[model samples]
Target: MCGIFAYLNYNVQKERRYILEVLFNGLRRLEYRGYDSSGICIDSDLSQPSIALDPAENGLADGSCKPLVFRQEGKILSLVRSVYDEADSTNLNLEASFSVHAGIAHTRWATHGVPSPRNSHPQSSGVGNEFLVVHNGIITNYEVLKETLIRHGFNFESDTDTEVIPKLAKFVFDEAKTEKGEQTVTFSQVVLEVMRHLEGAYALIFKSPHYPNELIACKRGSPLLLGVKELSEDANGGTSFHDSKFPTMDGQPKELFFSSDANALIEHTKKVLVIEDDEVVHLKDGSVSILKFDYNKAKNHGGLPRPASVQRALSVLEMEVEQIKKGNYEHFMQKEIHEQPESLTTTMRGRLICGDSSKAKSVLLGGLKDHLKTIRRSRRIVFIGCGTSYNAALAARPFLEELSGVPVTMELASDLLDRQGPIYREDTAVFVSQSGETADTLLALQYALENGALCVGITNTVGSAIARNTHCGVHINAGCEIGVASTKAYTSQIAVMAMMALAIGDDTISSQARREAVIDGLFGLPNKVREVLKLDDEMKDLAKLLMDEQSLLMFGRGYNYATALEGALKVKEVALMHSEGILAGEMKHGPLALVDETLPIIVIATHDACFSKQQSVIQQLHARKGRLIVMCSKGEGPLVCSNGSCRVIEVPQVEDCLQPVVNIVPLQLLSYHLTVLRGYNVDQPRNLAKSVTTQ
Candidate 1:
């Protein structure tokens, strides 16, 4: 829900202006993740000590320097302006150079307090600002720790859970220095001590004057990665680090970058090491060291053993920076919505083999091939995810159950955790997420692991937590979705799951023709999506007709039910309109009461097995003088909507199971236009974060 970016350079002189620019640009790349405030912390020139300090709190007798911190309650640009304004007002030198220095920046999505400068990150220990920390994710036990620190005479300036972290570090450092002497305690040791008391997800970067020329970062239940740029002669022009045991040229790294997402570091370096849970990364001099926190020892408090050293391999990132940019499109959502044709093709690139005169049709998923037998024999299959991922599963559920001959069920990750739902050893659980680092889904994965379920992950990210921890899984290959509202990933997910179902059902003879038909549909699916996207102008015009409305309603049944729900979600979240998706069968029960001429309603009566039922629904809604916008097949608009008064949206028809992938395209475009027409942020809506890292 928040973004973190830090930069460290050693043995290379860089001006303060260049350093601040790098930090600010990194945060700008992560602006898509959604945040209310932004801040940054950089080292001050210690020789001059430009910042004034309170005499009573100055630990250094000569009034030592404190880190330069700039925080603002709005966009990253505002924070940048604030920094320049301070520099201009004080006549501070922006040309000061440093050979070895570290800086950290953050974009915060509020959880513990209101959005204000006082509540922004780069939170410090006290008036002396002994320790500065930029943190992402929730600190579940912060209240208890805050109270204890307050009793110890530690005053807090910010009302953030992050404030407790720096104070706790100061407390631990003081206690350790008094007992073992100042030279005996290390920065990593103090950080490990502070981590022992923390209980929830967090990715933290700490910098202090006491530990100059060094930086320490640790993460648990949150995402973090280190990017390496080596300048040593042994580094074969920056390509040799990929094959090295560590992210170094000759036992040292020339530069280091830490970020919560690879997007922030892609422009700096492609070689990165994803930090695993409980691993503490320390950067000193010109080298890096990874230390593993021993949770078992911490629980017993048996004098807390020194953290064990670990090795992490550096992997090259596959994505290019151009993929994240909105080249010709006005907004990322619009670009992604139009990119569906190619994205769907990429999702099925090597997987679907269409039958020719020489061979028969087949579906190959190498990640699941070894475990297909166990999945086929499982007692049940459960699809677990949240939001768009969950809706994609719903879109694929009926077909999977029909082909696999297994009972398929759906569960929202949070609700499943609340109920402690039954997960059997014989069950196959599939976890789906675009980012793959979803907090509740990860917790549910741990729960399923404890219950012995055969867990599988389906995500777009390659090195995310779910991909690393699952027994086996699939990568959707829907490249670099930058918008807060997901578009291409939704279709790609359904396409992948459809292939999965075909693979599991390959042994049955009765469904051979059915499977071949689906295979043909798969081959033709991308083209169908291409055709559906032609309705963009139409959807935009429709949006203009309904943009002023206060609420919207959508109804569907069978396969397209997921389409209705997803469409409604897009409108509600990005368009800032109240909308609801209803089952056509349940319309008579309660939803019919809300139907009238003034309210706009969308009914998906597309060509499918449920076409007749949906046609009947259109008639029923028409009898009530409802303002109907019917989404139907190209030639079936007259059949679905016999009357001339109702608005009609004609979409290309595909296979029933594959229609949701095409059906959701127009709605995505409609939502994008409606959001722009309403003057709201289309890519990053208010009060929403792209990745739900907090409960």
Candidate 2:
């Protein structure tokens, strides 16, 4: 995943320093998206003879005045340092070095090219760098397109598939001009020609000297949002762009902000228009226009995509700006772990209700209400996801199968695609992801859709790809999870899925007691989660004890198996340790060999059908002098621990199927503490991302 940010000030030129500062601030806020390299393009005023454009340090110099691109092969901070260093050596003001009207910046998660300055973004096209482009998502046909462009005498500098966009745009622009027998063609027409030839998903933003006042953004299958601010309106209703917060050389009241995430622009404006697929937006002349891109028909007509007669209304973001920040906690992961109590409450709000006994407890999930009956009647239900989301699906699988009497199967999205699995119209396929844009999950959803299975999406992100493409879905309103290792979203996903299972089987008389029990457990979950969070200090103490251990093992049976897997994952993901989750039943088969006094083995023997079996497993481990850490029901701690022979972590008892929601909390805390003890970056773990947008 990558983050794209752009700014356009209408009617006034901004100081280069102010522009860079704002752009850099936006990129820093979006660092949660994860990136390996970053770059920025500033439209410089070349008419000023005092401005010296260094060709080597910047990009290849164009004969005409054009945007200057500065890129680095590492973090966004490194790029900022490079820019500031260059400014110091040249004796130029950061604000005056490259004054411009518009600029674009990008934090890249490399997919098409190696993580290097040469392969970084702000890719340009044509001899004078006519178009400066930044893009997200993949161009599946880039290889063939690149070959064709090379045959047409185009040279390339980087190995990125994105480099082909500018070259192809230049080719199309020249071809259209030649056919029209004109000295110049409109930039919008050239964009249409380029869109017609491009294939696969992309969210692209570009600037061209031909249309210096405007910035063009187009997207299909990738997220992009346009934020608009009214510069003329302030507290006193003045018409000046220079606000007290942001000082500007030329006062202009109008600014347009664009980003892949809404969080980046929340400080500037809450009103945003989410760009839909195959839509091109032109932000210029203090206005925005939306155009629908259709290739073949548009080519035969006037080489223009159909312009939308009416613009889509702006949607105000419900989340507050402060929610994105990690406050009171050292890391976003810790904050999220502590936020599960409220997140689960929000996820169940208005859905799980406790009324009179005559009313009977029930769930009302709006997105899945009408589809529950169909799902209950389906031949089978397939739960699909990747990583933490996958563990969440596994956590919900048992509850779904037990309540609805529907066989449920769990599949890793990638593996499902690799096997070319069978899906039928009678099946109900459910896709779960924290960021609805998980690449493999989205691909799996497409495959299931093609097989005619009814698709359902359960994701934390609203308006994500899976949510839009699925027939029906639930948004697990866990708020924004900035941590790379998911904490709140997993519990929230399980909560939503548990509610789904409750809704599907509530009407059956035989299952009424079971369903009521689960509904009651769900009602108590938020408080139970709050109670579990109290173990934070204890978990930290335990983590300190285990920090020196080289390997760790977690054992569980029944519903808590998912908990064990997820807990182990959290530790391994953020703590950077070798951890494995093994079924207690499978321990005799092989895993028992690893158990010893030197290793830490966490066991989940919480009250369930398999509680007795797990207790036996713990006894066996203890006999072998294995370092035992037992998680069990509140009062049963003594029964499982036996005369304080082993360490114990206690959790309040809940319904059998719903135990996973509470059981996972302490493990999450342990992982967080372990990472902190080891002095690792808890929020952004190495080589992991909040969202996996690339397959």
Candidate 3:
């Protein structure tokens, strides 16, 4: 997974100086999507444009007219610092010189290359820096293309598939000029030709000195959206193909913005276009055009391609800006972890209702309201997702099965694709993801669609691929989760699925008592979450005790087994430690071998059908001289930890089926504090991304 952001100030207006800040802020917002390294390249007309370079390499001398480039091996903030530091050391006003109207910025999640400064994006295609490219998605046939380019005297500095793109552009540019016996070919012409050679999913943005006023972007698979800012009559008679209704800024009716996600541009503009597969977008000083790729048609029509006569509609963002910012919090993870109470409220608002006992408590989910009959009649209910989303679905499986009396199955989206899992028309498959753009989940949804299964999407992103493609769905409304390690989204997903189960159960009379109790529990979940948040100080204290442990194990049973797994995932993901979540029942099978006084194991013994069994698990672990942290009901702590030999974390009891929702809060806090205490990045952990957009 990766993020791409670009901007073009066509009017060369005074606001041009803010280009770097614009790109910098955009990348910071997109950081949750994923990145191992970051970089930016700005337009330059000077034969000697100055910019920061890798610390390992000697930066180009000022006055050498070339695109200014800045790169770093870590987060986007590191690159920002490098850019400012370079400005301080240089005689040239690098910031002022950086005001070239067009540029691209990238945050890379490595694929086909190692995570290093050399592999950072803003890859160059021409020796003179004629073409600079920033890309998202893979180039499957890059090796072959690289070999060919190498034979043509193209050299590579980074082991990246993206490097092939720029080199290939240069190759095409040279080949075309040679064939025509001419010295010049338009940038669009060369790009169009390069498109004929590319295969696989890619969203690309590039700029050339030969075409200084334009930023060209296109995509085949990875998501790309375009935002237009209108200009006033003084600027260029602001014209927007969609509507041109917004107030113009500084004479220019609009500047253009491009990103992998609309979240990146919410602060700039909400009016945007979602680029379709194989469509090319050209943004110039005053005009923007969307082009369709038709090589044969282009060849027959003097190398000029047809524009997409179909004007794609623009959509407004429903998300608020405050949701994406971390207010009065140290990190997004902490803020989001603490936001669970409100998040759960937003999730269940108007969905679960409470009244007189004889009135029959009920749940109403509009998205699934019509599909409940179909779902109840389904032969099987398959839950599909990846990473934390998958764990969320697993947590809700027991509730779905017990309440709806439906056979339920869980599948990791990637594994499902690999096995080509059977999905019959009689089955209902639910796709869950925080950001609906997850490539693997999308692919799995496609497979499920092809097999004729009824598809339901559960995600936070409103118009994402999964949300749009599925026949029915629910939005978790978790708000913008900026941390790479998911917290709120997972809980919100569980809440939404729990609501779905409750809604389906209401159709039958035998389940009335059980369903009503669950509805009451749902009504109180938000407050219960608030009470759980009180465990923060306690969790922090406990984190200090366990910070030095090399490995930790978590145990839970039935509905809570999923809680154990997700708890382990959060710990391992952010704390950078070895952690495992094991079914308490599975201990004697093999996990028992790992128990010892030096090893810390957390047991979820909250009141449930498996309470006694969990008590036995605690006894077994204690008998083995195992260090333990037991999570039990507030009052049952005395019952489960009667011997008073182990430390216990008490959580208020909710309906047994919804207990996992409450039980998980303390563990999430522990992981957060542990990650901070361990001196790790709690928000953006290494080797993890907020959304896993690629397989």
TM-score of each: 0.96, 0.92, 0.90
Report the C-alpha displacement of residue 51, candidate 3, in angstroms: 25
lDDT score, residue 112, model 3?
68
Q: Over 4 Å off in model 3, which ranges?
A: 45-66, 85-90, 94-100, 179-193, 231-252, 292-307, 353-360
Arranged by lDDT with the best first, the candidates are: 1, 2, 3
Better by lDDT, candidate 3 or 1: 1
Higher-TM-score candidate of 1 and 2: 1
lDDT of 2 by residue, 467-513 (tens): 88999999999998888899999999999999999888877889887
Off by over 4 Å in 2: 48-65, 91-100, 180-183, 233-253, 295-310
Q: Pick the candidate with the highest TM-score.
A: 1
Q: CA shift at 198, candidate 1, in angstroms?
A: 0.5
TM-score of 2: 0.92
Pairs with backbone N, CA or C atoms under 3 Å apart (clashes), candidate 1: none
Local accuracy of candidate 1 as per-residue lDDT tens digits, 433-529:
9999999999999999999999999999888999999999999999988899999999999999999999999999999889999999999999999
The TM-score of predicted model 3 comes to 0.90
Model 2: lowest-lDDT 10 consecutive positions: 48-57
**Could you tally the backbone clashes for each prediction?**
0, 4, 17
**lDDT scores of the candidates, listed in order:** 0.89, 0.83, 0.82
- lDDT at residue 601 of model 2 (Cα atoms): 92
Model 1 scores worst on lDDT over the 10 consecutive residues at: 52-61
